[model samples]
Target chain A: MSHLKHVAIAGATGAVGVEMLRCLEQRNFPVGQLTLLASARSAGKTVKFKGTDVTIKELKADSFEGVDIALFSAGGGISKEFIPHAVKAGAVVVDNSSAYRMDDSVPLVVPEINAEDVKKHKGIIANPNCTTAITLMALWPLHQAFGVKRLFASSYQAVSGTGAQAIEELERQTREWAKAERKWDDVRLPADQVKVYPHQIAFNALPHVDSFLDSGYTKEEMKMENEGRKIMHHPTLRASVTCVRVPVFRAHSVAVSAEFEKPVTVEAAYEVLRTAKGLDLVDDPTLKKYPLALDVAGKDNCAVGRLRLDCALDNGLAFWVAGDQLLKGAALNAVQIAECLV
Target chain B: MSHLKHVAIAGATGAVGVEMLRCLEQRNFPVGQLTLLASARSAGKTVKFKGTDVTIKELKADSFEGVDIALFSAGGGISKEFIPHAVKAGAVVVDNSSAYRMDDSVPLVVPEINAEDVKKHKGIIANPNCTTAITLMALWPLHQAFGVKRLFASSYQAVSGTGAQAIEELERQTREWAKAERKWDDVRLPADQVKVYPHQIAFNALPHVDSFLDSGYTKEEMKMENEGRKIMHHPTLRASVTCVRVPVFRAHSVAVSAEFEKPVTVEAAYEVLRTAKGLDLVDDPTLKKYPLALDVAGKDNCAVGRLRLDCALDNGLAFWVAGDQLLKGAALNAVQIAECLV
Candidate 1:
């Protein structure tokens, strides 16, 4: 292996894929060579990296021949089909898809919470869900202090989380509203703009995210509980989440009410969180300082605010958390795991 | 009181007040005389009701002399100042403010849940908070079937809930984005557009609503537990809520996870809610037919969907509810109380 790693990004033209490339550059990841991989349609395209253009290559089983590390941001089907081949070719995988996340052989890792788990990866490490990763960035510190048992969370997720197509869909619908000079009360999307999401997402709140399960929870909603337990190494962690797609372009914000096994005061939780890495304490309501999605759009650190004792529960704390899903939730998290590998 | 009572609307130029006038006209309340009241700035403006123009008069202490029923949509401060004058003038008041909702002498009512509480009013009947009203519309019948113990809720509130000025702010911000042809990734408001809200609400999610209380829950967030207990006659009920102001224009949506004393099945809750008054159950996920905020805007009935047994809480159920804050949350609820009185 080279002293500088050979890093490859799958689905190089996608939204998260684009961010993954930027994260590699901005974080100054050691990249002796960079391979941009996508399907035939996106192949022959060139994406600029480090002042040089890297030509995209069509991904096949032989694509990882000389690759030392593979970052997968394509959908679950693509990851499931291609990851084993990457592993067979002697490349370690950091998958952002859910295909192998729950598998015993794959270690689901959040670097701030469980960076050590990255070492436990057999051939693959899975990035936690966007909402789960952002929420746990704050919750992990609180859990370390108070031992969280369960939480109720609702997400204000971005159109970008659905990938590049959904972002364009929201933009198109919004442009349609603008072209027609529509009133705020008269918001509607022309049918063409509703292609990406199940419904129109511009200026609307969608209660559904991902596919629904027999349990009536979306695949996105249950990730907080299933992924939280795995990533936190707490087998009994429970979460009820309503994953909502809002009109925001990039950041995702979560409103969380967490119950702890031990008593928690706002000051003590603040003490634990102020020193926690990869998180910011933004909780001055008098000055109207709290986490807002727009403020955290390009930020690497997730912001936590609205810290209060939950008057509704025993040993409970309620707070708001927001982060750039493209950064902490996906690309940055995946790269941080590889940094651990190095 | 005469069979055809004199009706007066304070804050007649505001969003909820305009809706209140429409509710009276559409619901065909027996209005012998209609009195439209606003501040001195809006005085002499005429609002058409029942195909007749009613001139706006400045709201003063002596304005309610001949009024038999007064509906107030003004802020809490205004409500507190003028409610006594209205009551002392022999006008039964239905106030849509927080000024007296918690006052022991006033009856806080959601007509479907507690119409009988209307008869127990001592001169004034108070309306529940908009988000609370919309949530309880779905939770009330289920509470009848399952006996709710506590709830955790997150709200996607509309700008109109903050009154006319907020609606204009969102519209202005959106128009600014359109005027500048700003990209979705470059969302920011000029300092002027940030007048109504503490921050830019367009393409963003604000976690602050109403004012911050000492416990860190906004006044709007705590309204669910406080008002739900009064309306449902469940004094021991506890609620933890995160009230978020989204860029939505009209409807407010709530995602609630409620624990009940008796075990709940989706079918049982459906059976109760389908037959309940002023609610429509929209929960078939296969067709992608859960409730969306856009689907409920301008509608009188609140829609409940996304039903499933909660996996996070014992004997808990989770659901999503959407309703127009103007109709079911405020105006229609106030008019319904008047109907009960008649």
Candidate 2:
């Protein structure tokens, strides 16, 4: 293949898909050609990429004709349907959905933690879940320093992680309250008004994310341990995560308490995270500077802060990690994986 | 003390103080006399209680002359100063500040867990921290049933937990975005606009809740284990909590993964939590019903749901708890402690 390769993005008009375009443009991927594919509904839409308008074409099994690399971010069903067609058409795929993440043949890559795994991919490389990817950006360094055994995490996930429609849902719901001169204490929209989520997302926290499995864990909550083990090559990594959707627009933050096999100190964890790749140590508590979702909204690097010794577990460390999910969790990670290829 | 006793509220103009007034009125406490105390600036303001307007008076060292029970929601310094005067003036003081929470002479009470501890109070009682109180409402029952050993918790705490100024700050910052007719994708206030919080609370999550201690954990995060042990009488209870301040106005929600001494099943946890005092089970996942922060905003009973066997730990269970911090965590709990006196 030539250094300047042909690249196609499936679901090119969605939230993550658009960010992938930005990442490609920002990273200056040597693109001989760029193909944007979306649903028939988004077919006529044109997105600006690097001072040029790229028209989005209707996505189909035949969409990947001469593409050297296909980035899939539509959803699981779309990836499951069109990925084989892309692979059969001779394009290597980097999927951003969960459909092929746990597949043994499809290597799940986080770039920083397991870039070498990219070489093991048969055809499709899987990008991790947003919250899992953001957390591992920090936890991976600590795990390298002090072998992590198990962790308990809770996610403050943003609405944009759900898609563009979910973002509109939050804005519309909140704008409804704003339009009415209601007091802050009494700010609420009707339950019937809520569409994207099971409940309201404005000024509220919904513990339910994705669909609930039979075991009472949401599929989103289970993704951390399941995907973390695969990416970190730590089969014994245990994670109990309660994924909650907050009203934040784009970034996702995770609070994690991890127990380690080796003795860990705050200073030791600080040293490891200070030099960690794709991560920033923002842990000066006295200055009231920590990793906040708002601060990390548009950044590529996930920030780690609020480092402390876990009082509940022996040799444990607790930290908060935040990142722009559209970037590191989905697009930038997928692009980084593609960079490993070129 | 008579069945109908005199009640005085210190810091009656504050958020929890106003809620305390409402709780006393709604719970139909026999109040023969009512006195409202506040700072000198709010001394002339009047608050309505049970269809009667009570003028606020400046709280002084001599304000507790005939009060049989004094509820203190003032800051810690006020509690430390005026509480001694109130105690000397023959009033049983129920403090909402953290100043005397760990005092050997003061009995910190969460009525659901330790109503009997109220009987042990010599002259003053302490209410648990808001997040800690709401979490323990659910965790204590599980501990009673399964003998909990340790737990990891992350709190999605509300702005109202910080009091009135914070509630206004969230509304003001968000209203600025809405009034400007800004796009939702660009909704943000200037960092300087953030007043009550160290940073903007609109569409953001702050992991630093309360002051930082020498150990790197915020004072709010450590309160879970410290106050949990005192309230539940579980001396060896271990809790690693990441206390986060979210943009929600009133209710606080916590996601907890607790390790128990005995093997536990989802059915057993459901059995235990179904009939637990001051906790409502809202755990039908198939129906898309779970404990949400919005639903529990003004509710007294903390709701627990999203129950599952913790995949991370042996004999572990993960669940979520949400409640109005003002009611159960502060105002209502303090009033219940006063009710024990009558």
Candidate 3:
């Protein structure tokens, strides 16, 4: 491990990309050299890091020449095309996309849960899905205390998770709605105004998240179970998830009803959750305190709340977990993985 | 049944109350006389009914005199204090609040499924909880086919379900947010501006809906199982629910995974839901079509979509349902009960 390493951030202009830059600077990851990479359209744009402008270069086969550690936040297509080059050039890749998460050779890592998995990475470590990472921050602790059998979850995902365009879309639609000065009941937007989402997302909830799979669950919904099993090394773990895109700007919240092999009480679950690394126990219903998307946005630590015993399942528990998808879910996790390499 | 029956609407100016007036006018209920009742602050305010303005009187024990049927939408405290008065005044009351729904003598009814229960009412008939009623519109039909054993559900509830003031709160906060010209990532609302909700409802989701029970489920979350038993006549039925309040101004959506005793298929569930009274099958995942809260806001019929076999449970089916909470969940159901009385 080098004391000071050359670090390159792919998709450096994206929502997660900007946050990766901030996390590196804030955490002061011994960076001797900084390189930013994006598409041709974003190439030449300068991103500020440590009060200095770092120019984004157009990603090419030779882009990873001298970079020792590369963090990828671009879509899966870009990762698939460019990650092999990074690996070939001897740059260890930490991908924040679904491209390589389920790969047998690629280590799917959430630093807190599976930092050991990073050492076995075949030059590519995969960051878990945003919602999955946020959820497992709390679930991993509980799973350690009481073996988890299955979980039923529903996500209140933010627009920013979709990228900068969706963020702009939510803001544009909201501004359009407010500019119209429409009363509460009369709030309506035309079809032409909504683009990023299939339906109007302003003041609405879309039950669809990622593309629908043949099994009826969206590709995004299955990531919880698929990624959870890999990261937790619990092969038989089952998760049923419904992912919905909400009007929120950032931070994703998931409501989980987890059934475990052992009987779990609120106090026991809290005991495990309170001391969990990278997680905050935000329960206290009497004070109206819970992990809210509004309250969790921009924070690195994910918050868990609304812990209760499951009413239907045997030896079950219900809880809500929230976190900034860009932080623990993406950029921060990516940087932490890079830290593991050095 | 009297031809010219007098009808009084308690909580006449509330969110559901205003919708109840619309349903009564649109459905053209046999209302020979209309009496609007509210608190003292709302007294003398006139609500237009069928080209006539009816002045609201302050609610009291005497207000229900000569009223043949009264529709109550006020909170439980108001219903507890005033519903008996309406019944004593010779009026059969259809209370929308949860005050009397669980009582032994009070017949909780969703007219389509349990209008027969209305006949057994001693003096009061209770409208089911908003989420329960909307969900049952789809679940009841399927339960008949598959013999539902238990259900796990999460709700995307609207602000309108909270009452007129909540609607105002969402609107006011949204306006404040837009007026501030804050970027999506920089949206930080002040504490004092939030009134109706414990946290900011704009661009956020709250997992707490109603008061939290000792078991960790909100009182509203338990209503599905509690009210479903009485309405569906399935006393042994079980449900685990997480009720969440989203930013939507009206209409509510629920993502449900129902495990049944009998084998159920997507095609079979579709067949049953297609002809289900007050339900429309809106699923077409290939085209990205599903039941959206915005699409069902002003509609009379609830919509169910995203039908798929539950990947995690045996004989299980997953579906999404949405409806106007003010209509099918409250006002229309209450009005339907009154029609049953006549």
Candidate 4:
């Protein structure tokens, strides 16, 4: 376990998969061997890892034969089908899909919140949902300082959270919009161009992020509370979340109103968040500086800003958090969990 | 007042101002004469109203001489300076600026919520803030049925709410990003190109919508509770609002968790929202149909959708409401208030 580990990334051609490679290389994650695995379509695609062209292999049940840590980010279905195989092949699986996140046997790990939970994983360690993970990067730190009771949050999610194809869809739509020289009033992307999302994502905001449950909350919306409780080890943490996909290409921003067991001040929250790992406090409203999605894109650290005392609830604080959904929300967090393994 | 009143639209060149002209024309406000007023920079510019070229005059203290109804949208500063003169000249002012909204003497009106309040105004009738008006359009109906006590809201506000220059800034910055052909990972507009906003609004979300208050909520954010209490005639009503400026050019959307005195259900909410004036119930998530910003843009009616029972609070309902910021939020609402006077 002390030696450099062999790492295999499933869905290597996807958005988060590619970022996982970068995080491994940038953070110098002591990888003895790196294997890139994807679907048959992207099998031969070459991804440059540390200036070396690593050919992506077709992901199969045998993909984790000699891999020590297999990172899965394809989708819930792919992770469900192959993650068990990775576990059977004696490889620890760090799954980025929601397929295994809620499983009692699987440890939902956000390294900063519950790194010790990584040690308790039998075979698979599930990566928290991107929105949930990014939120907890700040929330977990605050929860440590003041016991958090519940939160009401709304996410301004990005197109990249939908995967590589959705990113392409947004880019294509933006170009189509530019080509038409349409005024802002006529900015709806033509019906034919809006494929990835239900409606146009060019300049619109979609309130529905994931599939809706009978409770009327989207799966993505409930993931914040579901995953937050697990990651923070606080079973009673209630979260009412509205997941919205905005026009941004990368990075997700969340506005949260959290009520705590003890009274929380903006200054105290700032002091606690300033020293928190993998998070930066960027709350200066006078200068009009806060956690903006465009600025946080491609960055590892999640940024928290717009810190204020909630006017609605006693002992409540409202804040805005921005993080690269691909990095802190997905890849970088996954790789950091792998780092905790050895 | 009844015989085809003369209408003067201050800030007639701005986004909401232009929409005011459209609303007056579309809604057939029985305009005998239309006067367009703006700053000296746009003094001679001709804006087409009812297919007639109406020249813009500088909005001076004496501009409301022959005007019967003055719809002011220039800004708070201009309204403060010139509105007294408009009232002095015997023109009833439907002020769109926040200058007179909270004034005990000025009637802050949302036509749908309190059209009766228009009769109570001495001279100036204040228009509610864009986000607050859109939210109250839906909330008022539910409040009637269930008796709302408080609400926690987050707004996905469009750039048009910041006026015409901010709209242009978004359009120009978007074009800049498109021309650069930047990929999703590198999707930031150059720092030098960002203006009109403290941060770039293209493909990004800014949490700071208006100037911050000592309480940490932006002036724009607090307007909901402040204006809601006035418009709804409910002094005890509490609202915690987060106002965010998104890349969209028009249409402001709000996600609200409203707690009421009586019990609420999804069926009951739909029934109320469907019959509510100036609101369209657009809540069918199964069909992927909801109140989208793009669809709601340019539409006179505010759309309420994604109706669900709140999982976090007792007797609470969660819903998403979107409206054309220029329409129900400003221009059309102002025109409707003027209609009340007629």
Tell me the whole-model lDDT of each prediction, alpha carbons only: 0.93, 0.92, 0.92, 0.90
Evaluate candidate 4 and give its CAPRI docking class based on DockQ. Answer: high
lDDT of 3 by residue, B106-176 (tens): 99999889888888998899999999999999999999999999999999999989998899888888899
- Cα distance off (Å), candidate 4, residue A252: 0.6
Q: Which segments of candidate 4 are over 4 A away from where they belong? A: none
Q: Write the per-residue lDDT of candidate 2 for residues A219-249, one digit (tens) a residue.
A: 9999999999999999989999999999899
Window of ten residues with lowest summed lDDT in model 3 chain A? A182-191
Candidate 1, position B247, lDDT: 86
- List model 1 lDDT by residue over A66-133, tens digit each: 89999999999999999999999999999999999999989999998889988888889999899999
Q: Tell me the tens digit of each residue's lDDT in model 4 across B122-167.
A: 9999999999999999999999999999889999999889988898
- Please provide, for model 3 over A221-245, each residue's C-alpha lDDT reduced to its tens digit, 9 standing for 90 to 100: 9999999999999999988999999
- Cα misplacement distance, residue A152 of candidate 4 (Å): 0.4
Per-residue error (Å), model 3, residue A139: 1.0
- Estimated TM-score per prediction? 0.98, 0.99, 0.99, 0.98
Q: Please identify model 3 stretches exceeding 4 Å from their true place.
A: none
What DockQ, on C-alphas, does every prediction get?
Answer: 0.83, 0.86, 0.83, 0.83
lDDT of 1 by residue, B10-34 (tens): 9999999999998999999999998
**What TM-score does chain B of candidate 4 reach?**
0.98
Give one clash count per candidate, in the order shown.
0, 0, 0, 0
